[model samples]
Target: MSSAPVETVLVAGATGGTGRAVMRLAQSRVDTLRVLTRSSDAAADLRAAGADEVIVADLLNPEGLSAAVEGVDAVLSAVGTAPTAIPSGPPFVDGAGNRALVAAAADAGVDAFVMESAVGVGPEPSSPLATAFDAFIGPLQEAKAAAEAAIRDAPLRHTILRPGVLTNGSRTDLVTVADPGAKLWGVISRADVARLMLAAPTTPAAHNRTFEVVSKPRFPARNVSIDWTLP
Candidate 1:
C-alpha cells in the first residue's frame, strides 16, 4: 500500500509565478491546499484555482504568518523577484521574510520545508562556471544565500534546491544536481522546479538535502533516478 499523503500544506507567496505553479500542483495531489497572499483579490484567484484555504497575510507580519501556518503539515516557499522585477528596497524580502517564516513555521509546528535558492552562493562555489555569478547576480544571489543560511541552520528539516537559470518550459521530471559531476551548472524548467520542490518531503533521499538541479538527462524513457550519495 502507498504511504499516507501529506494532507495539508501551507504555501507562502502563492500569488507569484512559480508559487502559483506549486500551489496548483499541490492542490491536485494533496488533500488540502492552503495559500498565503497579501492581496485579497489574489487570494480569491488562488481559491478559484482550487486552493482549499487562502490566508491573507503580509510576509512582513510575523504574527499574521504564524496564524496562517497553523495546523499545516509543511511549508513550501517559491518567493522571489519577478522576471521584470528586481527589488531595491530595505529590509530585504528574501532574507528577512524567509527568516520570519522559519520562526512562524516553528511556532506552528510545521517541520518539513521545501525552499528554493540559486546554484552558486558559497565562499568558494566549488564549480568554476559558478564564478560568473559574483558580479552580475549579487543582489538576488546574496539574498537567497542569506535565506538559505537561515533554512539550513534552522531547527526544521529542510531541502533547499539551488536551481540553475530558470525558464518557463515543460517539466520533464528528469532534472539532476548533486556533488562531483553535478557541481557544474545548467538550466531547468520552472515547472519541473516546482514539481521537485513539491515532491521533496515525500522522498526519503530529499531529507536535509541542499542540491542543485539542471536540465533533463540525454537518455529518455529509462525512468531517471538521481543518486543522492554525497561526494
Candidate 2:
C-alpha cells in the first residue's frame, strides 16, 4: 500500500451499475480515484464524476489489469455479468476474468480487497434462492464463488459482502445479516453496498471475512439503532 494519509483506489468496470455506486461513494473517502473502463464515453463520465484518472483497460488483459491496479491502497471489485436471458452454463466470469482481478490486486500489493458476492454462493445452496440462483444465474454464481475463494485464500485483507436482491434505492446505511440463514430474505440498496465497499477499506474488523447483508424492514422506522456484526 502507498504510504500516505489517504490512498489511491482502482475500480474496474467503473461504468457499470454496481461500479458506478462504488465510484460515487468511494471518491469521497479517498485521495485518488482510478477508474478502469472499456469505453471512452464512460471514462469521460468517470472523470467528471471525480475520478483522478480513468484508464481504458480490459480485464482479460493481465498486463492492463496489472497496470490499472498498480500503487493502490485497496481494490473494490464491483465487476460481474448480469444473468443472461438463457439458463445457466458452466462457471462464467469467476473462473478467469474475476481471478485475473484478484491476481492483479494481489500482485499490486493492495492493502485490502472488498468484493460483492451472492448470498448463497458457497455452503451447499442452503437457501431456496440458491437453487433459483443456480438455475437462472448458475454460471455467474459459480464464478463469483470461485473468485471469492481466490480472494479469501490470498495473502491480502479481504472482505466479501453478499447482499440480497440489489435494489437501486437510497442509501439507508443500516443493514443486518445473520448466520442461521433466515436473515437472507430481503432486499438491499445498491447505494448501501457502495457504502460498505468504501467503509470496508477503513474498518480493520472487516478483514478476512465473508458475510451477508440486507436492508431492515421499515414501518415504525424509529431511531432504533441496530448492531451490525461484520464477519
What TM-score would each prediction reach against the true structure?
0.85, 0.85
TM-score of 2: 0.85
Q: Ten residues in a row with the worst lDDT in model 2?
A: 222-231
Deviation from native of the Cα of residue 226 in model 1, angstroms = 3.8
Off by over 4 Å in 2: 1-6, 85-91, 179-183, 216-231
In the predicted model 2, the residue pairs found to clash are 94-143
Clashes of 2: 1
TM-score of 1: 0.85
Cα lDDT tens digits for candidate 2, 1-231? 222233788777677667788888777767888988767777777899879999887675656787788888878888777666225554354455668888888887877887878777876434565566666776677778888889888777877888778898998867764432443656788888887777776665565777677785532322223233221
Separate clash counts for every candidate? 0, 1
User: Each candidate's root-mean-square deviation in Å?
Assistant: 4.5, 4.4
